[model samples]
Target: MMLAELVTTADRVGATSSRLDKTDALAELLARADPSELPALMGLLLASPRQGRLGVGWRGLTALDITHADDPLLSVGDVDAVLDVLAATSGSGSAAARTGILVDLAARATASEWDFLVRAMLGELRTGALSGVLLDAIARASDRPAAVVRRAAMLSGDLGETARIALTGTAEDLESVGLQVGRPVLPMLAATAATTTAALEITGEASVEYKLDGARIQVHRQGDDVGVYTRSLADITHRVPELVEVVRALPVNDVILDGETLSLDEDGGPRPFQETMSRFGAEVSRDLVLRPWFFDVLHVDGRDLLDEPLSVRLAELERVAGDWRMPGLVTADPEAAERLSRDALAAGHEGVVVKAIDAPYAAGRRGKSWVKVKPVLTFDLVVLGAEWGSGRRRGWLSNLHLGARDPEGEFGDPGGFVMVGKTFKGLTDELLKWQTEHFPEHESHRTASTVFLRPEIVVEIAIDGVQRSPRYPGGLALRFARVKGYRDDKSPGEADTIQALRALLRG
Candidate 1:
């Protein structure tokens, strides 16, 4: 297929607001795609290259000198071949090598094709379609159930390859895809609940496992060979040799264990999250020792247990993981759930995940099958600024710049506020309209992307916790901050103090 065809379809997809419309457009395009080129085409449609990060980011792309072509002539094969060359280039001379390849492609591609390619490479294509929508489109094009395709894609962790198989192969072929010991399947996610009572009401009898504020690790093992992957599926097997040793000692020969790992202090309590994140990011000799706590077992000794219920999976996990298992209990009562939550907190854990006892693992997506209960701290924070939204939220002032009051000027000017973090979560269209209409009245300054507001609007913000940060003046930032509501009753003076937030850090 011509690259322009995909580029034009992406433009159309971006222009539409309806998900069904996006799915329909993608399905139409996929229906016309050649079987031989389906994998590459699927990758482009998803705005991520099959090549994976090609060594050139937005900086490298912006530095190149380009001669834009007037005509569209690049084919799927042509672009994929160029990506191959770009991916092959490495070492000290790789930058210039990548620039040369991109310049040549730019010279041969039309303006629209160049735009699409740039967006795809930078991971900024606002095509209004990604895994979920594109998965539906693949299902629609192949005349298969979306569930079947979703399962295959989630199991494989490669949507492009999953689409290729679903479109080109039969029902039996799609069914043949299952849990592999080495490849990382998407980790099952949990939804948030307001209270333990609400979570228990939703899940009935459940296993309320202690939720750790640490890095997520999915361990895949076959005999002695083990690979540890992050939540995003980046293999970090070599980064933690101690962790590999722990997994290697597990009784089962072939296993995939889903768990969390955190560096522990001398008291055996978890260190501050930044310490763990720093260790997760760096591949170096470690100061703090990271302890692994297994919560779920997706596979054991060549037996795939992903489709098994939580009760069954827990039994399998107990048989293999032993004492390394995450601490939890089985109960339907909310008070017991609350007591377990308190026990977790008392034991120096963040919170607890309340999971449905009968629920099977749903990978790569958030669903109501599992609910996480945590103490939510809310504060009346001053609105510092906001940036323009995108796609469905386009034209609205979204992603608010939040601030905590610094009345004593510990970190800044007296009576001023400190910029903590930004959030666009829990916003409705009504709230978006209100912000667009209301924030302009208090606008102190403006930028290409942000409308800086005078510190007058007191908005209530909810957050899981605070993290030590160097980015903001307060030396602290809100973790998982979200909008609760605008606090019309509060003043800037009454807003939450930086000292108060920093205190949360000490706790």
Candidate 2:
């Protein structure tokens, strides 16, 4: 299929706000894609080539500028040539050369051209669609059930595998499917509750571990080699070399451990989350010291412990990890656990994750199975209309408007929907500039600089406290509430329901 056709469909999807329209367009586009092309297609759809965590990227800028310049320095052919050069040079030359080519491309292109290219490169054609939507499209195009495609994709972590299976015209159920290495698995997450008392009750256990504030990690080791992956399954072995050594030093040869990676102060206490993140780039060698705290073991000597109970896994972890085990495993009574949780909070940690001793390793599942209890933090919300961001944040008009979800769903419906907060925090400066520019495009109404966006973005905010309010929607207001990035990739529809807010307030 010509790239233009895909581009046109993406354009249509972006212009239309309806989910059905977006899905239909994406499906049509997926229909024309070759099975082998799925990754490249995903890359295009996600605009992976151009997305930067910080802002509108140089390649995206180049693509936009070159496409519509009055006296263009580079032609479409030249742009393609540059991409070819980039692809070829990506792994070769110094990082400098790679950056130079992209910079040159952007310098030669126009701002409008850069904008289009940016969207294309980020594959963020926000037409209210998601990976699930794309899976449905692939299924329809191949004349297969969406479930089959989804299962294949989930099991293989590769859409190409699903497409290939679909092309074979074979009907297969995923439950019977086996695991394939390199396939992506969704990360398991914990649900949040307003209080430790409530969270403990939900789990039917008086005992729970305070969820530690650190980066979640999954460690896979074979013999002397170790690989560390984030909750997102991105291989970050290079970033956390200390973890590699820690895992290598383990008594067991072949093992897979799941845990958190934390930065430690000279005194052995946990450092800030930012300090842990700083360990990712080259600066890590100079700045931060990292440590791995094992929580569970998944594979031991080629045996998969996923089916085993957490009690068994924890035992295996303790036996094999020995000295490398995470600290503070002493059994605590309910009251003690609460005190420990409070201590964690007082020490500036996020909160505590409480776990049941007998729970199985439910890979990629989230529920009260593991509950996180944190102090309630509120924010005065401002309703900002949402616009698309890059990669996984492409569609669904994300980044959020921060009005407190009304408990009563009445009052200014302040209980209903009153806008009182807005922020571009927790984002890099690049993201800030992008949001500032794009915020206007989606504006429903405007005050001088702050656009009164359609109430779409529902940010999951974390704050220090809530207080009485007179100017906001709810009679209550948030104190020092700020964006905690976007919630574990939830849709607006799946946001914390009004009922949840009511329960929280009542508690």
Candidate 3:
């Protein structure tokens, strides 16, 4: 098994959008991969190593050195030389090293090498493949059931665990089988419906609470010790010591709670989502104006509430959280819930999440048990730039540069706006066409098809909230902001004022 073969399969997978072709190509590649390299291969296939969230990376040269450095069997200079070759060939260290290492090992290498290397390195080998697909492939290759292989891969966080499980029938042979303190488990998610008609059918009631625009967090506490994790399962305990302290102060001992961590203003209202995100660091002061609002409990005193109905869990949650819980909690009442939802929106919060009282907790599942609704506020904003879209949106404007009014002359010249982040949603065919025509007029720079536009056109945008941002020159960013329409009626001066933004921030 050589790396060249893996690269070839990856090239085929990347070029075609057909799932069947991709799977077949992947199967062929997996067949040729050495048993030891299967984990890395699986990671490459799933775009896991490229995700960067899991701490596994493929930044060409730096990644190549780090990967080889972990191998006790390989020499330092050997890894460095491989990285050097990779840098020369691809200019991206790890991708080049990956190709160089494979080509150097195999005497017969050809034009296919370039194709394979490019696809694998770019991490664009999408073939309509799911994690389940790769699991089955590994099972078939190693002579194991897909379930056994899936569990091994998940428990060990490595595909080699699948091969090991297949070769050795014992489950104990798998590494990191038990739940570890720092390890991340996929957090449970809820399915949502858009309209009240759908909500009534799903829960038989319109019962809902306002859904604040904040980060979802899971807190695990054991007596005095506590840990907090994001929805992505990243351990952010060190970044949020205030949350740890708060969880530790809970009345009950040994508990697992699910909640949202938000930044609040001095008046105790929820701050912008961006502000909460900016506070995620070790150096963030303890006095930082942020708070954690616990919503549900999954485990308490070593007891798992996963099998219990929502009603039962809510009782436990209320008992444990008490005053620390989120503001609104309703039972089977629909009308009252709707009022609360409206009040949340009027107060400048996002929409609400409605959960069924009797629904059991389903971990890592998005079913019709829970729903989220947010009030959309639309304002005319200027476009600053566009990033090239990928996959289905490839070649079109993926994200747009958004800006708000600056009457105070604080951001730029009087009446001038600043660059916020970009968004891909809420664009109509007409708007896209208009942008394509007018964007070039304001083009300050161009990289490929992506053009940086001058802030001129006033495009209407609907947003969830406004939050403080370090990236934007205006010192603010929009939450879940998307295009609504082009505000042909209003000029740039008629756009929402900075005072309104400040009031929303206060709210």
Candidate 4:
């Protein structure tokens, strides 16, 4: 297939708001893709490369000076070969060589094709359907069950490879994909709820486990060999040697465990998230040892438990993890679940997760089987500025720069606002239209991509909490911030203070 075909299909996917239309567009490509080129084509459509990061950023793209071709002639294999060379470049004068290669490739693409290529390299192909939509597309093209396709993709931890197999092979081949030790499978995700009581209401007679503000880890061990991966299945076994040692100590020789790891202070309490991240990011943090807390076990003693209930997994986990298991209780009563949640909070943990006892592990997707309940703090903050949107949000103001009141010039000019962070979530199309129409009326200044607004509009923002940060002058920033709604009746002086957010970092 030509590169133009994929680019044009991506344009159609982005232009439509209908999910069915997006699935159809993707199905057409998957049905026509050659078996040999399926993996590379799927990677491009997903805006990620099988070779990982190409070491090229927006700055490198801006340095290129080339005229685009009037027509598209680059084949899928040609683009794949070019990206392979780009990924292999390293050290010395590789940056200049990368620029030359990019220029040559850019000169072979049309203007629209060039725009799509830039987004693809930037990993921001905003097609409405990625994993979920593409899963259906694969099933449609292969005449297979969606459930079987999802399981194959999740267990293999590679949607592109799964597409190639499903497209070229039989249903038996898809079913052959199973849990393998030392090969990380996608970790199961959780949905959020307002409280443990609410979460329990959804999943009755569930296990309520303590939720930690740390990193998700999937530990795969087979005898003497063990591999640790992050939520996205990136191998980080080298960074967490302590964790590797802990997993190796497990009595079982073959096991795959899902858990969380975080650094602790001298008092044995969980440390700040930033401190944990600081240690996790380092290749070696000898001073800070990360401790692992297993929550769910997928395989044990050469027996697969992914299709089993949480009760069965818990039995195996208790036998292996012992004291390392996440603290939790099994209860059918909402009141008991609430008590456990309160205990978790009293112990300085974030919250408790309520999970169905009979549900199978649905990997790589956020299913309703497990629900995470964390307390959210809402504040009326001022909108300092907003940048131009992309993909589906194009031609509108998005990614709002949030600020809190600074009455005494604690951070910015006196009486000015101090920025906490930016958020582009929780906005509907109507809200986007309203902001585009009214934000310019209050624009104090403008840039190529952003419009600075007067500190007059108050917006309600929700956050998990605040954390210590050197990026903002306020000495703290919001964690997982999202816009709740515009506070039309609130004044700038009535907005929440920076001290209010800073106080969250303590509690």
Candidate 5:
């Protein structure tokens, strides 16, 4: 297929508010796609290339000066071949090599094709064709059940491959996709509540566990081998050998554990989140040993527990993890849940996650079965721009202009970010220096005072709440907003929505 066809469909997907219309357009496109090209096709539509990060950034793309072709001549395969070269390019002269390749590719593509290619390379396509919608389209085009396709995608943790299988393979092949002991599946997610009591209202009788401010880790163990993956499914096993040894020591020969890992101080209290995160680097620090605390067990003793209730899974988790199990109690009492919440906070943890005792683990889905509670409101927001600092913080990009995801474009552009407010609080000297040095790489444009970004960075912000305001297009502004930290594990697409911020107005 021509690259122009995909770009036109993307434009059509972005121009409408109806999800049905979007799905129909994508389904039609999928129907015409070649089976061998499904992976690359899905990757382009999702703005996540099959080759992963191509080392391409906004600055690199903006540096090229080339006039695009008036007529579309590039095929999808032609663009994919170029991306392969760009992904493989590295070392001393990689920048020049990439620039030359991009120049040639740009000259061959039409103006619209070049625009789409840039957005795809940067993972910033603002079309409403998200993975869920695309999965629906695949199911529609393949004449398969959406649930089957979704389950296959979730279990395999590869949307592109799942698309190919669902489109070309039989129903039994899709259904056969199951929890493999060694392959990491997507982690289950949670909703949020103001308090443990409120969370219990949503979850009923719940296992209220301590919600640690640590990195999410999914450990898959088979015999003596263990692999640790992040929330985004990036394999970091080599970076965390200590964690691997810990999982290897588990009594069960084969198991899949879902939990969080963090470094603790001498007193056994959790350390700062940033300090814990640093353990994820390539260099293993013997001084900072990370400890694992298992919350849910997905598989044990060659049995898949994903379909089991939380009550069953927690029992299995206790038998396998023992002391390493996350601390919590099963209760329906609001006062008891509140007590656990206080204990978690006093222990320097985030708060509590109240989980329904009877709900099965719904991987990749954030349902009401599990709800997180925190005394103070914190949200994941996108950094839209950063102002040049003043006074003691001069030469640093300090004040962050934050944005919320506008998936439906009620406030502005569809599938774009809506500016909510700005803040300069909670930044340490290390963060200030880091921002000053790295912010230019993502620069979209800049004035004398501020440098606007491409909404690629996700930062966790603590806000007292949100107040109704006309100063921003979202009609709401963050109250006493302060940075908690950068959530490197999350994507801009996972940032909290403007409607979610607006709901704070009602509270």
Candidate 6:
């Protein structure tokens, strides 16, 4: 297929607010794609290339002085080939090679195609075709069940692979995709509630488990071999040898355990989140030992428990994890739930997650099955822009300008975000350095004092509450906002909504 064709379809997908229309446009595109092209095609449509980060940033693209072609000619395969070269090019003199390659590619693509290509490379594609929507498109194009496509994608942890399989293979082939002891699956996510009582109202007779402020990990063990993965399913087994050893010590011969790991202080209390994350991020650091707190068991001894109810899974988890199981109690009483929440908070943990005892694990889906309750007011907001620091913090992006999601276009563009607040508080020197090094990669534009970024980085912010304000588009502003941490696991689409933030006024 022509890259122009994909660009045109993406334009169509972005032009409408109707999800049905978006799905239809994407399905039409998918129907015309060759089986071998689905992976690269899906990756482009999702603005996440199959080759991963191509080392091409917006600054590199803007630095090109080549003129785009007038005629449409670049094929999807051509773009994929270029990206392959770009992904492979690195080390000394790689910048010049990448720039030379970009110049040739840019000169080959038409103006519109070049625009789409730039957006795709910069991770700024604004089409409403999210993973879920594209899964529907794949189902429609392949004449398969949406549930089957979704399940396959979740289990395989690759949308492009899932699309290829669904588009080319039979129902039996798709169904054959099941939990593997070595491969990582998507972790189940949680919705949020104001209180444990409210969370219990969502999940009756719930397992009120402590919500640890730590890095999420999925450990898969077979015999003595174990692999550890982050929340995004990136393999980190070599980096987390202590965790691998812990999983290897489990009595079961084969298991897939989902849990959080954090470094504990001398008193056995959880360390600060950043300290835990710093330890987690290090390639080799044995000074800080991270302990696993298993919360859910997905597979054990050749048996898959993803289809089983939470109560059954928890029983299996307790049997396998013993003292390592996350602390919680099964209860229907609101008071008991509140007590657990208080105890969790008292232990320096985040709060509590109330999960329905009978709900089956729905990987990669955030539904009402599990609800997290935090007494502190915290919301995930996108980093719209960051200002350079002053005084002791000079030369770092310190003051964060936060934006809340405007999903319905009530306050701004649909699926865009509205600026709600700014903060320089709670930023450590390490975080400041990170902002300085990485913020430029996401930069949309810049001024003397601030560098505006594409709405892609999600950061968790704690606020006292919201107050009415005439300074912002949303007519509400965050009060006393401070950084909790960057949520590398989440996307801009998953950021908290403006409506949800404004709801604080009522409280």
- Can you write out model 4's per-residue Cα lDDT over 1-507, one digit (the tens) per residue? 989999989888777766677778998998888888888988888777777779997667755778899988898888899999999999899988999889999999888888888877765565655567788888888888999999999999988889998999888999899888887898787776778888888998899999986778899998888898887677888888899999889888899999998888889889865566565567675688899999999999889999899999999999999989999999998888888888888878889989999999988767789988877756779998999999999999988999998744556443458998888888888888889988875676899999998776888888888889898778888888887677543456557778767756764
Across residues 1-507, which tens digit of lDDT does each residue of candidate 5 receive?
888899999999988877789999999998898887788988999899988889887877867889989999998888899999999999999989989999999999988899899998889888888888898998999999999999999998888788888888889988999999878888899988888888988999999999999999999998998999999888889888889988888888999999999999989899988887777765554578888999999998879999999999999999999999999999999999999999999999999999999999999988999999988899999999999999999989999999999877787666689999999999999999998998888888999999999889999999999898899888889999999999877998889899878876784
Best-fitting candidate, scored by lDDT: 5
Instruction: Please identify model 2 stretches exceeding 4 Å from their true place.
Output: 15-24, 49-117, 139-184, 326-333, 346-348, 356-362, 376-420, 423-461, 464-507
Consecutive 10-residue window with the lowest summed lDDT within model 4: 407-416
| Per-residue C-alpha lDDT of model 6 across residues 224-331, encoded as one tens digit per residue | 989999887878888788898888787899999999999999998999777777765677866898899999999999899999999999999989999889999999
| TM-scores of all candidate predictions against the true structure | 0.76, 0.68, 0.60, 0.76, 0.94, 0.90
Clashes of 3: 10
- Candidate 6, clashing residue pairs? none
* Cα RMSD to the true fold for all candidates: 12.2, 8.5, 13.8, 12.0, 2.0, 2.8
| Poorest 10 consecutive residues by lDDT, candidate 2 | 50-59
TM-score result, candidate 2: 0.68
User: Total backbone clashes of model 4?
Assistant: 0
lDDT for model 1, please.
0.83
TM-score of 5: 0.94
Cα lDDT, model 1, residue 36: 74
**Candidate 1 structure quality by residue, lDDT tens digits, 262-329:** 99888888886557766666767587778899999998887888779999999999989999999999
Query: Residue by residue across 1-507, what tens digits does model 2's lDDT show?
Result: 544455567668666655566667877776666655555555456544321232334333333323344443543334555665666664345466756676776666655444545555543334444455567777777777776677566545555456556654456543344343333354556776766666666665533554555777878777777787776566778888788888888888788787887787877677766567666544346457778778777778877676677678878988988766654443336676678778877766667777666676666556666777777543224345543455755433344456544322354321135444444446555545655665554455654333555444445567655555565555555556566543332333334433334344433
* lDDT score at residue 423, model 4, on the 0-100 scale: 89
